[model samples]
Structure formats: C-alpha cells, structure tokens
Target: MKTNPPAVQIVAISADEAGQRIDNFLRTQLKGVPKSMIYRILRKGEVRVNKKRIKPEYKLVAGDEIRIPPVRVAERDEQTVSPKLAKVASLADAILYEDDWILVMNKPSGTAVHGGSGLSFGVIEGLRALRPEARFLELVHRLDRDTSGVLLVAKKRSALRSLHEQLREKGMQKDYLALVRGSWPSHLKVVQAPLLKNILQSGERVVRVNSEGKPSETRFKVEERYAHATLVKASPVTGRTHQIRVHTLHAGHPIAFDDRYGEQEFDRQLATTGLNRLFLHAAALTFTHPNSGEVMRMEAPLDERLKQCLKVLRQQAQ
Candidate 1:
C-alpha cells in the first residue's frame, strides 16, 4: 500500500527560481507527476500563487509565494545511468567548454537535448547523472535529435534566464552547416517564409510553410559546391521549429538525409556516399556571457562520418 506524500506548503520564489513558468516550476517540484494532472490542478484553481488562481504560463517572480496541491504519485525508482554506458559516458569527452556559469558541448547526432518523447534519458539527464553534486543544470536552448553540435547548458538559473533573454532578443547568433541537394544560387541569400507546426495523427511533428504560420527567416551562403549537392552555411534569424530544414525545403533544396522534409532520391544518392544521418550541424554559436557580459563564440567541427561523406562527394566530383 503506497501512501501519498504530505501536503506541500507555500513556497516562496527566490531570485534563482524567478522567470520560470508556473507549469514548468510545478513539474520540477512535483516530480514524477503527469503533466495532465498538473494542468488539471491549475485549471481547477487547486494551485494558486499568493492565493490567486494563475494560468500555467504565468511566470514566477521573486518574492512570490506559490501553493501546490497534494497529489498522488506512484513511487518509481529513479533512472540511473551506468557509468559503463559508452554513449552517455562519451559526453564527458564531447564537452567543448565549461565554467561555473555554463557548459557547451558538441552534441552528437541522434541524441536528444533532453529526455522525453519515449526516450529514457538524453544529454541533460546524462549530464545530471554525471554531475550529481551540481545543484542546477538546465538547457538554455534545444537542438533537434538528429542535429548535432554546439549545445549549451546553463549551470545556474540566472545564466539560463540570461541566455533565454538573449535568444528572445535576437542577441544570440547560431550558424549551421548543411549539405543540400542541387546548386544553391549565390543570389538567393535569404529565405523569408512563415512556418506552421502540425502534429500528425501518429504524434509525429511536422512543420510546413504556410500563410497562417509564424514569420521565419534563414540566411544562406554557399560554402562549397559538389557535383549534385551544395554545402551551405545557414543562419536562422528566427528560432522557429524546423526553420532551417523547412526553409531549405521551401527554397527547393532540402538537406541531405533529412528523414522528414527531404527527398528520397537525394537520400538514396547520399547513402552511397556514406551519409547516413541528416546533413545539418550546428557549426557555431555566438553570444554574450551572462556573468561576464563578454562576447563568446564557439565552433564545433563536423563528425568524422560527415567529413568522410564530404570526402567521397569531392572524389566523385573530381
């Protein structure tokens, strides 16, 4: 017979916890609780801030008091990452830079930024498992599971808030390297399109260019030219979901090996060239340091597999 935990008392929001949404904060406080239950409580006014009903999206402010309702939660064993697990352990070597404020790593392709969506664990979880002593560790931004490179993690709540603000204010500069089908016209430097995200009945997410979508823009520059493909540098001005992938697709040249918005023939051709993964990499990131206020730039080199693919493409072109 499992017993529910004692009722939670009013929690005063600290400066470190400020700026986070009520729903997200609740998720952290009420660990293992289902998101549906959290929303239900909020909708029914069972959860309140300063005795006032608040929406899930309401951001917490310093000095605010929050009241969390008691809820039944199943007692489940915490998922632990075995040190012998090669993939999770390899993250130690993937780290490009780390300090008291933030940590930057060259994330491997096929690895999700954080665990969810049927995945047991991901970069954030693995990191937390690795550093049990660290009090705060959170993702400042996210990268697609298939996209690799330059992923940032904040070690402090203040750093996370600052970095998020930079992203919102367009102060962060993110650059990607993508190998696309066909020759990218030099004159076509930018693609300004609106993107709408749609969830299929099967629960897969897809983004498309539509009039009803949010405005998006991606700047492109031809980096190298191959026989039937082109390597382009992509800088997304807007952080829309699948902005780069859909923008390149809208430009009539989808990325190589992109399972979702790519051409089957292009993937088949690249398959022979040793390109088995999406040809999109977060090559570089530039932003101001949250603590020091100094400009920081980091670059990640393409993986060996991607480099070998490029070598094969070059040989064929020659």
Candidate 2:
C-alpha cells in the first residue's frame, strides 16, 4: 500500500545543497514522485520557498526554507544490477580515472549512459549498484549509446555545477575519432551548419542540417587515410544533438557503421572487416578539475574490436 505524507514538510537548505535548481532539489527530496506532479504543485503554489512561490529554475540558496505539500508517492521495487553480470561487473575495470569528486570512465560501445526508453538499466545504474554506499552520482554530460569513450560522472552537486559551467563556457575540450567514407579533403577542415532535431511519426529522433536550426560547428583533421575510408579527429566547437554526425553528413561524408546518418554501403564494406558498430569514439577529454582547480586530460584507448577494424583498414590501404 502507498501512503501520503500526513502533513507538509519543510526543509532547510544547506551550503552544500545550494546552487541546485528548485525542481532538481525536489526530485531528490521527493523520491518516487512523478516530475509532472512536482511541477504541478510548483505551478499551483503548493510548494514555497521562504513562504513565497518560486519557479522551477530557481537556484536554491543556503538558509532558504522550502515547504513541500503532502503528496502520495508510488512505491516500486528498486532496480538492481547483479554483481555477477559480466557486462555490468566489467565496468569496474573500465574506470579511467576517479577522485573524491568525479569519475571518468572509458565507456564501452552499445551501453547506454542512463536507463530509459525501453532500457531497464545502464552505466549509471550499474555504477550505483556496484558502489552501493555512494550517496550521490550523476552524469555530468551524455554520450550516444553506440558511441564509446570518455564519460564523466560527478559525485557531488558542487562538482557537477563546476563541470557543467566549464562545458557551457566552452572551456572543456572533447575530441572524437571517426572513420568516414571516402578520402576526406584536407582543405575541408571545418563544417559549420545549423542542425534541427526532428521526430518521426514512429518517435525515432533524427537531426538534419537546416537553416532554422541551432548553430553547430565541427573541426575535422585527417588522421589516416584508408583505401575506402578516412580516420579523422573531430572536435565539436558547439554541442548539439548529433552535431558531429549531422555535420559530417552535411559535408558529404558520414561515419562508418552509423545506421542513422551513415552510408549503408560504407557500413556494409566495413562489416567484412569486423566493424559492426558505430565508428565514432570520444577519444579524449580535457577539463579543469571541479575541486582541485587543476587541468586534467584523459584518454581512452580503442577497444579490441575497433583496433582490429583499423588494422584491417590499414592493410586494405597498403
């Protein structure tokens, strides 16, 4: 049976909890509560800060008193990852770096960053299950499920804020490696295009290059050329949904094995070389440590499958 709080509860914000948005804070406080219900209460003035209604985006400050109305919460069994599961268990070895404030993982391909949209669990969930004692863990940013490589997770709200600030200000650097069809022209180093996200009737999301879309830019540098493909380093100057994939497609070259925005023929050709997944990888990341104020650069080595594919491509080139 479910139960509702008998009376309104008031919470006093602390210094460590400050800087989070009101809606986000509510999420942590009211576990098992639906987001729609939370917003509904906020809209109806059922929730208040210092006896005054506040918007969902309001940043919590230390010493603010929040009034939460009584609400019924649905109870469900918590999701847990089995420690014996090879894939989830192997994540412990994928850690590239970890500190008190953050964790950097060499995320494997085909693993979603978070669970949703039919997935029961993902990397974050698996991590939580593995480290049952950690109080807080959240993704600082996201990567496509099929894209493998450097991923960051924040252990504290303050660290998340600091890392997000770096991302917003373009102070952090993200470098990706992609194998694309055909020889990439050396002169075509930069792709600047606007990208518009669209949802089909089937609910599948796709990004296209459109004038009315958000501004996006990707800088590409040829790393090595194969007989039928080119390995390039891609640096996204602006982050947008599928920016790199869309930009490469706009430039007449698409990533190999990218079913969404890639060349099918190119993918078919590479399949013979054992390349069955998307050929894009988040090769490296450079960012300032949230707590130490030190610049950190981390790199992830290509998995064996990717390395084998590259070897085949090199042989074909020769």
Candidate 3:
C-alpha cells in the first residue's frame, strides 16, 4: 500500500508587498488558523519560504515560493488567550493590499510591531489570531508607534524575499507630509547627518546625530507655509533609525506636533491646529514589482486628524 503526501498550499509573491513578515502573511491567508498554532509550526520547521524554514518574524519579498503543510488539530495544555488579541484580529478588514503572497494594512499610530516590553498585543498579534491557515505573514518595514500609514505585510516567504531586495537597492521610494516650523529655505534640500545612539536613563535611547555616528540623509521641499511655520514634504534616501525625525531637528525646524524632539512651545501653539497624531504620515510609496519588474505605487489618504489640521490652517489663513 502507498501512502499519500499531505496536501500542500503553494503561492507566488509580488513586489508591491516588499516589506512584510512570514507569520503575518499566514494569519491573513488562513484567517481560521490560530496564532499560537502557527508559531508552533514555524518553530518546528513545518513552513518553508523558498524551502528554508524562516522565523515567524521573517521579512518577505516577491517572486519567492511558499510551501504550507496540511493543517492538523492538536490538543494542548496552553492557557487561554487575552481578549485584546481577539479584538486586534478583527481589524484585518482594513487590508489595503492582498494577493497570494502578501497583504498590507494602513497601520495606525499607537501600535507596536509586536507584543513585547509592555505590549501584550499589537497589530501583528491580533492579525495572527484572525488568520489561521495562512502559512506565513510578516512585516516588511516598521513604523513608529505614533506615526501612521502604509504598513506592509507578506503572505508568504517567497514574496517577502523579492520585496526586500528592492528595499536593499533603494529602488523603493516613500514620501511623507509634515507640518513643520518656519519657511523652508530651499525648494529641494537633503539633510545629511551622522546618527549616534544615546543611552538614556528614562526616555527612549534614540538614534541621534553626533560626530561619531552613521551617515544618514533626508530630502525636503516646502509644500505650504503657516504664519509661524511651514508645511513641508520630506523623503528619506537612506533608511535609518529615526532618520527623518532626527534630521528635521538637526535642521533647526522640527515637525509641528513632534512630542519628543519637537519644540514644546511650538507644539503648544499648534494645539488648536488639531494635529493630534504626530504631524507625519507615510503619504506615498513606489517600487518595482519583485516578480514582474513593473513599477507599483500606493498612496495613503490623509487621515481625519491631518485633514482637520489642514482645515484649521486654512481657516486661520482666511
């Protein structure tokens, strides 16, 4: 007698999904599968991205192949999960991009990458709970806890691999919009600085510029101006920790609502501006498809907070 091989789920990926994780991909695909079970399978080498067993947090690129094992039910003595996980799982309906290989969400501010330090649940954790059979789901890039827009998630490992290469080559382009201080001096400007890590006693040990730091750069241009400030469009040429935030301050003009590096007095004046969520947004992104080499672009609409701030600014001008 011959035995049959377990049914496999195979998928091909694309580049618009350049930055996503493996585990997050599966959760979206297999909305019925539980996160704990998926994590267990990944740890045991049951899932493969291009035939290599990748961790749950493995980043994805396009054109890679994925293999998923047959699902099986196993009784475990694990404890019950928290209700917050269940709540986050329901947010999957907000997906902006989805294919066999990936799904990207417009990640809102105030969310963490994963559950750690103090957060027991994040966008990824909740998504995993909702997607069960998806063999992989992963985050391609990261956003600050208080920054909103254009978050990427990979549906499979192969897709993760293809998308990542574009990021490495700097073929991916991302643009941001911010309400900043003062009239920008130039129509086009690039802020080049070196970043160093500071060991802080209480606040975040953030990356800052110093004499002995890594080289970083950001480009900026004016979009509009307020009575005491300027609304600028900014782009980062190199992906570094806090590259934009640090460079903006390094130029003596901080973002309007920056709570950390922002001028407190300026932030206070902008209070009526209704810019509650750090005045930074991932406005647009463009990159070559990892699979087809075709160019792809995705834009995030201005959220309510920013819109409200714009309304106030316009009203103030009138």
Candidate 4:
C-alpha cells in the first residue's frame, strides 16, 4: 500500500522558497513524515544546507542546495475537506479589504492562523482550500489563535517584502483593545521594558521582563474603567512575541482571562461572569500600502462575545 521514495534527494531553493524556515520547508518536502521525525533529522544533522548542517530555524536563500536523507514515509491519504474547516471556508465572507496584491480579513477568535500542533487545519489552510485559483497567498503577519482582529495577507512576493520592510521599520501601527484585571492608573501611559523569552522543560514558551532582554515598549491609554477591570487601548511600539501580554503583566495589570500571563484567581472570578476567552482584540491596523504607497487604515469591530462581556461589566458597574 506504501512505498519508500528515493533514498536521497537534493533540492535547490527557489526565490519563492527563500526566507522560509527550514522546518516548514521540510514539512512540505517530506509530506507524510511526522513533525517529530523532521526535528529529529535536523538534530542528527541528517539534513544539510550547502553540505553543512543547519538548524530548523535556518532561513533558506535562493539557489542554496538542500540535502535530504530519505526515510520511509507513509502514503498520504487523499485530500478531503475537513468538516471543521467548513467554517474556515467561510472566511471569504469576512474579507475586510482585498486587491491584486493584498488581502485583509477580520479573523475570528479561536481559529489558528495556520495548521500545526495537533490542529487539522486553520485559517490559512482553509483559505487555500476555498480559493483554489490563488497562485500565491501568504500571511503578512500573525495573530494568536484566540485573538480576533484584522489580519493582513500578501498576495505577491513583492508586496510581502515591502510590508515586511514596513514592519521592521516600525512604520506599521497596530492597536488592540484589552480588558485588564485592575483599574489602570490614569497617569501611567507608557511601558518601556526589556523582555526575554524562555522555553520550559515542558516546551511551553514564556516571555517576561528581564534586564538581559530585548528592548520593548507599549503605550496604553485607558478607554473605560470598570469596578474591577479596565478597558485599555494598547499600541506596541516594538513587536515581540507576547509583548503586549508580558508588558501588561509588568504593569501589574494582566489582561482579563489571559490564562498564560494572568492571575488564576482573578481569571476565575471573571470566568464566573460568562467570559471564557482572553479579552484582547486587534482593533485596528495602519500602514502604507505596499503597492500603491497610499496610507491605509483597517479596523475590526470587537466580536459580539467581547462586546457582550463589556456590556455585562458596564451593567454591573451601573
């Protein structure tokens, strides 16, 4: 029913493949191989770039040769539409903006941007399935699985490069609405801290403020103050993994229902009020269009669930 592929194969990186992480490239190249196997091969130096061992995080460059050692791979099942992805297929209706070179959508919460880590499929996979005619589509940026908001996708390589430049230059602006656990100080507006990332023995990632860390900054402005929670608009000046969550924790006001960086007791109390998910949302994004060079601003309204939670909180305060 299954047969091993060639014992070994060499691949030359193409311009479109350049800048992609080696691990992802392996996943695509070695279809049907488990992710663990891919990582194991990398650890054992079984995979090489230009005849030298490279780590999983290595970014491929155009014309670089990759040496892949063949291992038995199970025959992949025929592609079928995942029932769970049926909803993902509907993301086309949520399009906020689209053009020849760019696409934007109001990504729903509880949906991963891409499929991995036990997920069968995600937004990107779903979109690809829905638009079979699209030749090139790639996420320009990422949002957490549980964060709802405006998401940008590039439809061309040149657009992706230009937008990445904007992000690196900090010219792209993102605003988020978050409900924090405590009353935020009116005078406390700016948070400048250094964040360090740590991977626990269990493979869980965590970010915290540490002296020996990368410089990070976030600007907070109170939008609404509740009895036990405060609604704030957060603008991160430096993009880092979990920068907003870590910075909020550093300010002694972790976001409400933020299981990772929040206080369990506080979260439990809020959980009793029908709030089941984190209350952080990507409210808006502003950037210069990569193709047109015109300034563009996109906004995603708070989802009904988040809006209902705020309504309940305000009613209680009244």
Top lDDT prediction, candidate number = 1
State the TM-score for model 2. Answer: 0.73
- Candidate 2, number of clashes: 0
2 against 4, candidate with superior lDDT: 2
Quote the lDDT for 164 in model 3: 88
Select the stronger candidate by lDDT from 3 and 4: 4
Q: Which has the better lDDT: candidate 1, or candidate 4?
A: 1
Native-to-model Cα distance after best TM-score fit, residue 142 in candidate 4, in Å: 1.1
For 1-318, candidate 1 gives per-residue lDDT tens digits of 975577866999999999998988998998876554576688678899999998767999999999988876544422343433446557766878777899899999998987778988799997886566579999998899999999999999999999999999999999999999999999999999999999999888999999999999999999999989999999999999889999999999999999999999988877768788999999999999999999999999999999999999999899
Clashing pairs in 4: none
**lDDT for model 4, on a 0 to 1 scale?**
0.85
TM-score of each: 0.74, 0.73, 0.71, 0.73
Candidate 2: pairs in clash: none
lDDT of 1: 0.89
User: What are the clash counts of all predictions, listed in order?
Assistant: 0, 0, 39, 0
Give a tens-digit lDDT track for model 3, residues 1-318. 965655889877679654789878887766566655666678678889899988777888898787888874433412344467545643554556655666667766677767776778777776676566667878877777777777777777877888888788888888988787776677448889999978688647587789799888889988887777777888888888777888888899888777777888888877887676688888877876655677878777777888888888878877
Ranking by lDDT: 1, 2, 4, 3
Error of 1 at 206 (Å): 0.5
Query: Candidate 3 — number of clashing residue pairs?
Result: 39
Candidate 4 clash figure, as a count = 0
Instruction: Using TM-score as the measure, name the better of candidate 1 and candidate 4.
Output: 1
lDDT of 1 at 251: 96
Off by over 4 Å in 3: 1-90, 201-203
Candidate 4 worst ten-residue window by lDDT: 73-82
